[model samples]
Target chain A: MLESIMHWWEKKQYRIAPYLFISPFYILFAIFMVYPICFGIYLSLHEWSGIGEMAYVGLENYLNLFKDGDFYLAFSNTLWYMGASLIVNLVFSLILAVLLNSALVKCKKLFRTIYFIPIVTSVVAAAIVFTLFYDRDYGLFNLLFVAMGGKPLDWLGDTSLSKFAVIGLIAWRWVGFNMVYFLAGLQSIPKSLYEAALVDGANSLQCFLKITIPLLRPVILFVMVTTLIGSIQIFDEPYVLTGGGPADSSMSVVIYLFRTGMEYLNLGYAAAIGFVLFGMTFVLSWIQLNLMGAFERKE
Target chain B: MKRTLLLILVALMIMVVVGSSGAGAQEEVTISMWTHDNLYVEFFTRRGEEWAALHPEYKMNFKFTQIPYDQLWPKILTTLAAGTGVPDLIGIEISAFSRFMKGDIAEQALVDLTPLIGEEKEKFLRWEPYMHNGKIYGVESALCPVVFYYRKTAFDEVGVSTPMETWEEFTQAGSKLKEKDRYIAAIESSGDTPHHFLALYYQQDGAIFNSKGELMAEDDPRAIQALQFLQEGVREGILWPTSSYFDAPHFAALKEGRVVGNYMADWWSVYYQKPQLPEQAGEWRIQLLPAWEEGGRRSSTAGGTGFAITKYSKNPELVFDFLHYTYMTKENQIKRFLELQYFPTMIEAITDPQITEFSDPYYGDQKVGKVFSEAALQIPVQWQSPYWSEAIQILYKEAITPVVADKKTPEQGLKDAISKIRALMK
Candidate 1:
């Protein structure tokens, strides 16, 4: 029996060894990712309170989501955050990356490390600090504004400004993260291209517009897609900073889902919310990738 | 052959000695507990040592894990749902208790403590929040009576007296404080549940739900009145609107004397007030919350926690005995009050001299326990509903913020909150 088993193993080793070596990833992906997605779908079709029996109420949770005003508010707030952060973070990081990649810059590594510190910093700690910075009366922002002959504005108390307050925290934490990617992209672009453009009598702005942007398309596309996905799932900043408050003006989709599932124990409804979020993320990402010509065949 | 027989005799003798020793030894039992508050763990650890000293025949091994507030409930709920790896005891917050009692799972997950409580129920003050269908599942850790904490110097500076008797006088004092460029109290308009509102509403005998767990806030005039009082205070510039309670910014306002008074539970003093504002220790005082009317109830309950035995516990009776000895007994109840400064729920402990005569230099030698115990007896029952978490979220968004921010009238806001909460119930 031992000789036969050894002979069979030797015969199949080439074909089976690779799969045997790579089985861990597939096993984990199926257990953690695929199982949860399938279970979430199953859970979305019922009414459950986490511990009790799940009662089937097909399509009701979905139908209710359409009419849920709080869901719409949370959806719109999440979009506002995504749109604002994408614009602010992308522009700011791009500028920093361009500056840092320049030959005239001093201590480039030091500046890069300093900028990247926020990314590695604990978000909860950063949020606590930012909360103090956004305080209505005693915050640094308000104090500076008042010193500059302006009135102290309620940065977090007013519903109109609470979203911006949370967005400010998001931008602070993420701009550096995106900048590192842009910096790599900027460095990867050959200096010879810019030299050629300057030799052709193009001004600096023209060279930047003509050579730099076109070469950075792939990086830009990558950053935009990742940023959009991250923004859609934003929870920590708003949760720790504003708590989705001032009348839910800063509420993100994930925060609402968390409150529903964890706080309210409406697990089935929360699952429905989760599916809706997944759908939104999928459709938006696809649109983004398509618009960027990611799937287009090159000639 | 003789040597082999001698070795066998020696092994038999050793076996007999070991068996006799094992028979004389005490059985060991391990009990695992999970709590959100480290203070509870500290309190119980000391009590557990005392318990071990008294009961020597059984060796008690306790395993206590203190989890953060946000993570603990989800962990406990998931464990309960999976029907495995449950702790022997769980400390449940008052607001989260409804989640545990949502379905028949409560019956399956928690041991019915009613039989354990038995005749001692009459001695306890607040049990409504932990009850479902006439069964008690948790023993409350504190009475949590909401009291008005004020800066005595601020009031004296404004020529307003301490311990105003009615809401009318409280508002009158607010105007006087406003004249001095100070606010009477800081009311939270964002990032908090309607705890202050609920305290006042409960003071006027208002409830979000009746005994049947039906929606009653819309029709309850007291709810509207309570909200209107807060709105009027803010509009008149008597009350400052803070984002959250017991946070840094709120404490800053207190320190700067921008805000002077706070209506919060007794636990706030020990956890927040004294620790945060240590410099202003002797300048503060505690009083029964001013009545809405001259003769209304002076106190209402806001926040609480309770400990319950899980059905998964191997020794439910032993756990109950431990709880009864530590929490339900008069001596330990007063001891808890003296140590934690949480007002006792036991009627006997509330009046105990150890509690009633206790004074604190932080409040200028005020008998803090006496004031709290007085409020403890008058604490109105707060009904529980499965929709409680959702209802409070709606109440804050639809009613508390809009009404206090002057975006909507009290009645309109209450109407909106009611409709939203009702829709949730459906």
Candidate 2:
């Protein structure tokens, strides 16, 4: 009887094994992600302070989110940062990769390692170091500017200028990481394409534009999308360096959501803010892809 | 083979029962206390070993867990919401203390600390902050009364005496002192204007909330005047602006003779000046914060923390036992002040003859304890509502920060903060 039961169990296991293997991920996702998102959506229609009774508030939270000037300010800041970083990152990382890949540049491995160092460094540490650099008085940047006959500028303290300072910090950390991808894309392209261009009397610039740019388009698009996604969730650099201050000039959308949810404990309103950001991200990503012709066939 | 498997299993089961029953005799009741204060953790961990030795019969174990100051509130909120994983005791920041006191203490997921205060509860200074109705929910172990920290060397060079008797004298001194490239003080930029604003607002008996927990800051002449004073200081170039009070630039300014005064708590006397500005060791002195007018209220609290026991605690009595030994006992409170530099909250500890008599070399041989003790008594009792955290942020973001940055006039900033806070209450 035992032998029969064991044999029967093994046969049943063969039928159900694949589902059982995949169930853990789906179960965890349902619990952690799906449940929270749904609950958050439910919470968006109520007012709760965690310890107090949650009072139902209907669509008021979303209405208030639309009216909040701070929300619009933070949203604009995040978009500006995302756009500026995409252009600077893609252009600069491509330049760095091309220069490092050139024949005249020796010790490429050592140079690449040095460039990649900031990618692995902690964001908080880099933000702190950059804060020292950007100090209005007695900082390296200001002193250097003064030495070169320019008046010292308040880099992180001025509302108009703080967004750019945050952008510069993001560039310092992510430029090398983007270059590594471009380097891989450059390496994978057959040398024959470049050689053929050279044989056709094309100069280095001509070869770069014709062979590199057109072929590296896919990698550039990937870099742009990933950078945009990362930008949508940016928090630490400004949080550490400027604290989103000098008058909330560097406050990103996600940081505003965080302050609402964690600091203020307006979970319902914070949930509405989060979903609005989610909608914005989805539409923005969609528009970005269409503009970049990501879905177009290879030419 | 099957019989052998059964016999091995039976033997393992018998071993498990005996071992489990034997281990029950030595099981220790570990009480976890969470705090954001790192110095307190190191002190408590050492003291806990002593506490455990004295209570060997109970088989007690004490554990101290430190959380970051900002994250502690959310951690408590989540654990309480989930109804599990709450530590036995938590150090509640004074800013966050009011939010945890829902109707009754039990409904609020806090153990009523009424029994802990016992018969002599009147002696706990600033104890009003952690109590509700007739019951107390927590007790502070430190008095964080603000005092004026000034540079004696800078004042002497400018031909001024110690402790400008009033703000008018302080400002007059600043104009004269600037010839030597010195400012009277550094009003921390828009970023930290609220803290200084609070100290000044308290000088004139301004309260953020009335006794019945209503928003009351609109058109308060004291608050507006206090904000205007700070803005005027910045505009006159008497108050240098740093990103915040304790940032790198601020420290550099404090270390050198760039700025002279800091209106901060007594703890900063040791924590900030002793280590950060050691060169100004004997050149520094403590004076009561200069009054808004002659003989006005002299001192107020900026920030501090207190201890609260969680309702989820399996042994609330035992947790309070440990807290009482550490905080309520007169000898331990005095010991904490004498050794660890944590200023006392207990009235007896604050006025301990030993504490007042000990001379601090850092402050030019000033009896630091005696000076601060008198200042602590002058701290006016002000009621705080749960909306205080929200109100303070609005004051910073809408009023003080914008005013300092010149984005808004001082009057306009104050009006905006009032309107915004009014909207929040709705």
* Candidate 2 C-alpha lDDT tens digits along B1-426: 999999999999999999977776656787887898877787777767777777765677777889997688888889888988889888887777766643232347888888767786877787767766656777785778888888888888889887777888888888877888887887656462366888888778887777667777778888888888888888888878667566677777776678888888766766677778777788888888878888787787777777888888998887788888888888888878877677777788778898888678888898888878878878776666656666777788888877876678778888898898888777
Which ranges of candidate 1 are over 4 A from the true structure? A1-14, B1-25
lDDT of 2 by residue, A64-158 (tens): 98788888989999988888988889989999999888888999999799889999999988887898899887578999999999998888778
Q: Which DockQ values do the candidates obtain, in the order shown?
A: 0.77, 0.38
- The residue pairs found clashing in candidate 1 are none
TM-score of chain B of each: 0.96, 0.89
Which is the leading candidate under TM-score?
A: 1
Interface RMSD of 2: 2.8
Per-prediction TM-score, please?
Answer: 0.96, 0.91
* CAPRI-style grade of the A/B interface in model 1: medium
lDDT (10s digit) by residue, model 1, range B1-426: 999999999999999999878865766878788988888898888889898778787789999889998999899988988889999989898888878767655687899999888988999888888887888988998889999999999999978877999999999999999999999888888765678799999998889987678887875789989999999999999999888566899998989998999999978888889889999989999999998888888998888998999999999999888888878999999988888887889999998889889999999999988899889889998888888888888899999998999999999999999998998887
**Lowest summed lDDT over 10 consecutive residues: which window, candidate 2 chain A?**
A258-267
DockQ of 1: 0.77
Could you say which candidate leads in DockQ?
Answer: 1
